[model samples]
Target: MQGAQRNSLRLLQWMMAASLALPIALFAIASTISYNSTLDIADREIERTLDVAHEHALKVFETIDRSLAELNEVVRDLSDDTIRSREPALHKRLKQLADALPQLKSAWIFDANGKSLVNSLASPPPNQSFADRDYFYSHVDQSIGTFIGTVLTPRPPYQGARFFGVSRRRSSDDGSFIGVIQASVLPEYFESFYARIGSDPGSFFAMGRTDGVLLAQLPRLDRDFRLDPNGQVGRSIAAHPVHGLMTIAWPTDGLERRIGYRRVAGYPIYVSAGLETSAIRGRWLTTISQHLVFGLPATALLFILLAFAFRRTQHLQLEAAKRREAEEALKHSQRLEALGQLTGGVAHDFNNLLTVIRASVDLLNRPQLSEERRQRYITAIGEAVARAAKLTSQLLAFARRQTLKPEVFDVGERMRSLRDMLATLLGPAIEIVTQLPAEPCLVSADAGQFETAMINMATNARDAMQGKGRIVFTVHAATSVPDTLAHLSGSQTLKNPGFICVTVSDSGVGIPAGQLGRIFEPFFTTKQVGQGTGLGLSQVFGFARQSGGEVTVVSEVGQGSTFSLYLPRAPADLLPRSPAPTTAPAVAGSGMSVLVVEDNIELGNFAADGLTELGYSITLVDNATDALTELVSHADRFDVVFSDVVMPGMTGLDLAQAMCDRCISVPIVLTTGYSQALSQDGIAGFELVQKPYSIEELSGVLHRAARVKRVRDGAAE
Candidate 1:
C-alpha cells in the first residue's frame, strides 16, 4: 500500500510540471508574434513616407520639364526660314523665354559652321565656337528633339560656370545639319530646388544623371564631372531596376542605409532619396528595450504567482480572462485619447468665445454708456452668439445628433443666388463660376445649411490658393447613388433612386489623402492659427446625415479638391413653386394653452418662462409619465402638446404613440436638443423646432401648431 501511494505522488509531480511548461511556451510564442507584427507596422510606415516623397518629387520634376519643353518647341520653331531671316527678332524672343524660365541661364543659336550667331544675353559671348564640343558633334549628324548633355568648361563664349545644356538639332529645309539651338541650366539651380524639401539629417537627396554622374546633392557636394563605373554605387545602379528601394551597407562609410531612387521619365536624369537605417529603427529599438525592462519581469512574476495558485480553478480562470480584458483596455485607451483631443481643443475655443461674451456684458452694465459704445457692445454680443451657435451646431453634426429642416428646392437656383456672395467672400483674386442646368435639379435639404457649406468650401479654396484661384459650383441630377449612411454603419448600397449632387470644385492646393478620413472631424484644421474654426466641413457632414443624405470628396495634391453634397431627390412637384422667402411678417401668439414636457428642471423652467412671455399659457412637467398624466387629467385645458423628444422611462416618441392609441385629439409638436428618434426617423407625426429658439421664433412655430390643433379639434367635434 505504501509503494502504491509513492507512485501516485510521482505521477502528480510530472503532471504539475507539464501544466506550467505549457503556459510558459504559449507566453513565449505570443511575445514573438507581437514583436513581428509591430516590426511589420514600422516597415509599412517607412514605405509610406518614401511614397509621399516620391510623389512630391515627381510633381517638381514634371513642372521643370514642362518649362524646358516649352523652350524646346520655340527653339525648334527658330529653325524655320521666316524666323531665321529676322535674326534680331529671334534673339529678342529667346531673351524673353530665358527671362521667364528661372532654370534657363542663356539661349544661343549656332550656325552650320558651328559659329555662335544669335545670343540671348545683352552682351553676347565673343568668338564662341562649338566645333570640338560633344553637343555640336552629336547633333551635327542627327535630329535629336531634346538632347541633354553636361558641360565641363567654357569652350569660349559659354564663359561662366559648369552647367547642363538641353539642346535640339537645327536642320535645313533640305534635311541638312544647321547646328544646335541650346539652352544652359546651371547645376546650382537643381541643387537649390532639392534643398527646399526638408530631408532628414545625414540622409542624401540627390538628382543624378542616368550615366552614374551625381548632378546635385543637398547639404553640399563636390565631385568629378563623371562618377567612376567601378564604384559600388555604380554597380548597384546597374544591378537594380530604373526605380526601386534597397537596404545595403554604404561602401564609402560602411553604414547600413535604406535608399529609394526614381528615374525621371523622358529625360536622362533620376532622383535618389535615402535615410540611415539606424535612424529609422531608433524608435523600434527603444520599444524593444522597454518591453525587456517591464514585460519580461512581469511575465515571470505572473508565472510564479500562478504556480502558487495552481490549486485554485477560479484564479486560473481570472488569469485567462485578463488577456481579453487587456485588449479591451487598449481599445478604450485609443477612444479616450480621441475624446481628450476633441475636448481640449473645444475647451480652448469656448474660453475665447466666452471671454468676448463676458466682456460685452460687463460693458453693457456700465451706468452711463454712450450710444456708440452700447451699439458696439450689442454687435459684439450678437457676433459672439452667432459664433457659439455655429460651434454647437458643428459639435452636434460630428456626433450625428443635429436637427435638420428639410425642404424641396432647386439646387441650381441656390447656386445662382450664392454666386455674388461667394465672389465677395472669396475676394477679387478668386473667380467664382457656377454651372447651373437650365432645368431645375431639386433636392430635399436645409437650404440654409447647404448654402453655409458652399460658403465654407469657397473660403477653404481661397486659403488653399492663397486668395488666388478659381472655384466652380456644379449642380446636377445623378441617376444612381452609391450609398446612404449614418456615421457608424460603413455599409454600401447601390440603387437608381437618384440624387441631386452639388459639387464645389476649387483650383487650389488639395487636401492630403492621409487627412481625408479626418477632414470632417470637429476642431481639426489644416489652416494656420486664427485662420479657421475647422467646423465648416463637420457642419456639412452633420447636415447631410440629419437630412438623410451623404457627402464625399475627391482631391489630389497640387491639382485641387472637389466636395460633393448628394441629397436624395424629393417627389417632383408638378406646379411652378414659389421661391423661399428671405423674410416674413412676424406672427404673434394669442393666449393659446401649451403643455411643455422636459426632463431637465432648468430647461423646463426656461421653456415655460419663454412661452409665457410669448403670450401663451404654459404648463411644464418633468417626465413622459407625468406629461401623460397631465394631458389625461386636463384634456380640454391644453390646445397644443409641446414635448421634448428625449426622456427617462417612457420617451417622447413612446408617449406620442400612447396618445395616438388612446385617441387623443390634441396636436403633438415635438421639440428636441438631441434624440435617437431624430436620427432613426421616429418623429413621424409631429412638427419639430430645433433648440436655442428665441421667443419670436417659438411664437411663430406655436401659432402654426395652434392652427393645426384647432382644425383637428373641429374634425373631432
Candidate 2:
C-alpha cells in the first residue's frame, strides 16, 4: 500500500512539471510572433510616412521651378525695351512686373555697363557690379537666359537670404546686347511649400541641395535636435544597408532612441523616423519578468485544478474582454458623430447673424452724416465689421456654406499678381518659379477664392520647405480626365476636354503616405497646436467643389507632392471681365407710397422705417394675408406692393396672384432670404430680390417697380 501511494505522488509531480513547461513554451512562441508583427507594422508605418514627406518635397521643387520660369519670361519680355530712351517706361514696367510677380524678392534690370535701371527691393545693389556674377557672365556667354545659382543674403538694402537669378542679355530694338535683366526670388515664398511637405507630427522632413547642403527642414528642430546629416546620420544614409533601417542612438526624453532613415528619390533629401526601443518594449519585458516570478507557485498548484476547465475559462474571459473593447469603440464613434453635427449646426446659425450685421453697418453710412464724423464712424464700424466677417468666414468655411460666385479669369494674370507678395512672404531662402501660358486660358471660377486658395496652398508649401527650398506654380490645361475623377460630375465623358489645371508643387521634404488622405479634413492637421488651424485644405476643397471643379493631389515618399486644381472652362464671351460694382443706390422712396408686408414684426418695422427715411410713404403689416387685404381695400393708395416671399398665412407669390385676381394693377416685388418653392417659372411676372438687402438695393428694386406700375396705369387709361 505504501509503495502504491509513493508511485501516485511521483506521477502527480511529473504531471505538474509538464503542465508548467507547456505554458512556458506557448508564451515563448506568442512573444516571438507578437514582437515580429509589431516590428513589421512599425517598419511599414515609417516607410509610408517617409513616402508622403518625399512627395511633398517634390511639390515644393515643382512650385519653385514654375515661379522661376515665370520670372524668366518676364525678364525676356522686358529685354525688348531700349536701354537709355525707355528708362522711365522700363522703370514703370519693372515696378509693374515686381508687383505682378510677388514671389520675386527683388527684380532689377542691368545695363551692359552694369548700371541698374530698375530695382524693386529697398534699393538696387549699389553700383551694379553684377557683371562679375555667374548669372550675368553666363547670359553674356550663351546670349540666352540662364537660371543661375541662388543667392543667400544678397547685399542690402536687400536683406533677403534666398534668390534665384534668371538673367537674359537685354538688347536694344536693333537686337544688340545692352545689359542683363535679372530677377531674384526670396526664401519666404517657399515657406508655404515646406509647411505642407513636413507637416507630420512625430516626423521631420527636410530637403538638401545637390551638394548636400541643407536647404530646408520642416518643423525646424531645435538647434540640438537638428541633426547635421553630414555626420553620423548622413553616413548611415549613404551606406544604404539592407531593409533600409538604421537604428541610431540619440538622446530623447532622457533616454536614447534607435533612429531609422531613408533617402528620398529624385532629390537630395533624407528622411529619418525613430522611436526608442526601450520605450516600446519596456512594458512587455517587465510583464514577462513578473510572470516568471509568479510561475513557480502557479505551476505547483496546477495539478490540483481541472486543466480542461481552467483553459476553457481563460478563453471565455478573452472573448468577454474583446466584446467590451468593441462596445467602447462603438460608443466613441457615436460621440464623435454627435459632436460633428452640433458644430455644423452652430456654424450655420452664426452665418445668418453675420450677414445681418454686415448689411446694418452698410446702412449706417448714410450721406446725411458729416464727412469727418462719418469717416471716423466708418473706420470704427468697418474695422469691427471686418473682424466679424473674418470670424463668419471661418465658420462658413467650416460648414462649407460660404457663397462662391464663379466667374472667368485668367490664371496667368492672377499668378503674376501673387509673385511679388510671395517673394516678400517667403523671405530670402527659397526660390519661386512660375510657368504660365503666354495667351490667356480662362477658367470659370471665383478669382478671389482661387487666389486665396493659392495663398493657402502656398503657405502650406512654404511650411514644407522650412523657409529654404523652391516652390513652383505651373498653369497647364489637363489633356485627359484622370480615372479617379471619372465618377465626378462633368468629368465622365471628358475626352480631351481642355480644363485649366493650376499645379502648386514643391521640392521640400515630402508628406507621408498614411497622412495624405486626411489632410483636407477640417481640424485634421499634422501641425502642432497654435501652429495651424488645419482649415486651409478644407477651404480649398470647398472652394473647388463650389466652383464646379475638383482638386487632386499626387505624392510619393521623399519625392515631394503636387496639388492640382482643375477648373472648368468658361464661355468665350465671358472671358473678358468688367470691374465689380463697389457702390449701389440706396432704397429711397421718391415720395412713392409703398406697401410692406412681412411676418416678422421687427423686420417689418425696420423695412418701413428705412423706406420712410428714403422719402417714401410706408404702410407695414404682418403676413401676406393682411398685405393682400390692404392692397385690395386701398387700390390707388399704394403705388407698389413689396411683400416678403415667405409668410405665415400666405406666400408673397400667393398674395401677388390674389391681387391680380382682384384686377389690381399695382406692381409686386417679392423678397426673402430663402425661397425653395418659388421657382423662376413661378415668379416670372414678379420682380424677385434676395432678403437682408441694404436700403440702397431695396430702393433700387422699388424704383424699378414704380416705373413698371406707371407704365401699366398709362396703358389702362
For residues 22-110, write the lDDT of model 2, one tens digit per residue: 87787798678767665665566667755665565555444444544553455554543344346565556566666765556656777
Candidate 1 lDDT tens digits, 1-717:
345545654555555675557656865675677557655654554456545555655554455456555644665646435445666776787788778767667777777767766767744435556766665677887776666676455554346767666676777667788777777766666566656553545465666677866666654565344655667667777777476667766544567766667776677776776666776666455666676687667666766655554545445445646844764464344334333434455566678779999999999999999999999998987777766665565555433423466777778877876564455456668888888889878777777677767766666777888889888888888755654444313322333246778888898889999999999886678987756656667767877777667888899999999988888766566324684552354454478898888898998898788778767888888898988888788878888888888787998888888889888767788887667767777669588867755555666777888898778768989
* Alpha carbon deviation, residue 333, candidate 1 (Å): 14
Off by over 4 Å in 1: 1-353, 370-387, 390-589, 715-717
Best by TM-score: 2
Candidate 2 segments whose C-alpha is farther than 4 A from its true place: 1-371, 379-497, 504-509, 512-552, 556-560, 576-582, 660-663, 678-685, 715-717
